[model samples]
Target: MPAPPSAAASTTNSTATLDDDEDELNDLRVAIAQLISLPQAGSEVKEKGRAALHGTVEDMRAFLDTGYRLAQAQDDRVALAQLHSKPDTSPELKTAVRAILRTSDPEEMRWFLEVGQYEVDQ
Candidate 1:
């Protein structure tokens, strides 16, 4: 059989793993900060990002992987609802918001919130 790894080799591997984990954690922190700073982030995204900032590494990773998108989608839905409910909102904008709400694609909804709405308004 092949020889087992030496203690030095084991320590080096462990140190590398720690370094990787630390790097990932730092990246997550930066992502959360950026998300929180966005004007369109809505309440759910901001709340989730704030929670992730204080949570464990796994929590941070989860936030970046799936939580952020899900939270943003929820916030986007709320925004659409608010737009639809507004008294002075143009028919074109309301129809566009309704169309976005019918679709299941989060990116499409996000796009509508970011760029498509302005196009509709203009």
Candidate 2:
């Protein structure tokens, strides 16, 4: 197996850490207590002071599709994981993701991006 999905992952908090008693977790817990005791990540979203207009869906689509082109070798596991985690984007976004998943060939997906529904505002 792939080393038991080691807690030693590339991205922060991307995987479940094995050491529940680790100093980092304790420190994080304390820090979290302090933070929650304050506001922001602790406070509810409705309590946020100021927020601006969100980015366009097109922009988000482009950002998600960055780096690799269709059929060019991409991490399906990572993509699936991300999609599975986010249960609150949009129906259209989810459709796009599902469409991408439906594509068996990555190269074909790339073509779709190049000359398909992958429309990004300039």
Clashing pairs in 1: none
**Model 2 weakest 10-residue run by lDDT:** 44-53
The parts of candidate 1 lying over 4 Å away from their true place are 1-17
Q: TM per model?
A: 0.80, 0.27
* Model 1: lDDT of residue 30: 95
Clashes of each: 0, 4
lDDT of candidate 2 over 41-94, digit per residue (tens):
212321211111133334323322442222133444334336545776456655
| Alpha carbon lDDT of each predicted model | 0.91, 0.40
Model 1 quality (TM-score) = 0.80
lDDT (10s digit) by residue, model 1, range 1-122:
99999999999999999999888778889988998888888899989999999999889889888999999999999988998999999999999899889995899998888889999977
Model 2 lDDT, full chain set: 0.40
Candidate 2 runs further than 4 Å off? 1-74, 108-122
Worst 10-residue stretch by lDDT in candidate 1?
22-31
